[model samples]
Target: MAKISAFEDLEVWKEAVRIGVEIYRLADLSPLKHDYKSRDQIIGAAISISNNIAEGFEYNNNKVFIKYLHYAKGSAGEVRSQLAILVAAGRVNNEDYEKLKSDLSGLSSKIKSFINYLKAFNQKKK
Candidate 1:
């Protein structure tokens, strides 16, 4: 495995970035464009997922990184929740919403796995 020296090199972070871009694209479509509140909130949550991962990795501490990973994971969940709201509000189509929701859910799972790995490694070092 390649050494992960930066957050951008992380698969989880990359997935988060993709999820964020997709959220923006979805927000640009139809009624979401007019719903400024939901648009901003969803977009912010999506971006936060990747941002937290990157910020935490830069901290150079596994514990701190894990904390940030949790934040990112929470943001992913938040985006998924927002997607459901947007779909129910008729702001997003079923197909688009399902795709984004799946992606966010997958990202959250990846983050959780990474956190588990870090926690295990930290425990081993103790």
Candidate 2:
């Protein structure tokens, strides 16, 4: 495999960006748009997933990258939890809710796998 020099090259980062955009669009079209607190919180968490991944990768250390990946994974869970709240509050439709939730779930898994990979690599280096 080729070396990953930029965070943009990461599939998990791409997925996070897609989910972030979807959440933004969802908030714009759904009743969530009218809900300032929920809208902002959901958007923040969605955006954080990608941001953390990029931030960690920039550190250029496997340990640091792993830490950041965990942060990204946590943010994905936050987005999923907020999504559930939005759906329960009737702010988001069932279809969009399901799709975004599934996306976040997959993203979280990917981030976890990446973290494990980094941890193993780091261990081998020691």
Candidate 3:
């Protein structure tokens, strides 16, 4: 298989961006009008996931990149938690909530695994 050139080329990052788009769409349907707080928070967290990944990849330093990966994972968790709140408050249906939750979980795991892989790779080079 050919080598991947950047994190933008990574399937995980692509999936994370898709998840972000879905979150934005969901936020638009939320009944909490005049509450820009939660909506912006959720959208920001979702965007952070892919943004961090792209920023990390551009850094080219394993340690810095891993830090950004961790940030992305945290942002995923934030988005997941916010979605859970929306579900509990009856703002989002079970179907949408579950689907987004699962996607976020997968993105979190992928980011963590990528971080571990990079750490190991760098260690081997030292």
TM value for model 1? 0.96
Tens digits of lDDT, candidate 1, 2-35: 6698888999988988888888888898889999
Candidate 3: lDDT over CA atoms?
0.86
Tens digit of per-residue lDDT, candidate 2, span 49-83: 99999999999988888888999999999999988
Q: Model 1: how far is 38 from its true place, Å?
A: 1.0
Off by over 4 Å in 1: none
Query: Mind giving the per-residue lDDT tens digits that candidate 3 earns over 2-113?
Result: 5678887888789989998997788878574345888888888899999998998888788998999999999999998988997898777889999999888888888888
Local distance difference test values of all predictions, in order = 0.90, 0.91, 0.86
Ranking by lDDT: 2, 1, 3
Error of 2 at 31 (Å): 1.0
Collision count of model 2: 0
TM-scores, each model vs. reference? 0.96, 0.96, 0.91
Checking candidate 3 for backbone clashes, the offending pairs are none
Q: Candidate 1, after superposition: displacement of residue 5 in Å?
A: 1.0
Query: Residue 111 error for model 3, in Å?
Result: 1.0
RMSD of each: 0.9, 0.9, 1.6
For lDDT, the strongest prediction is 2
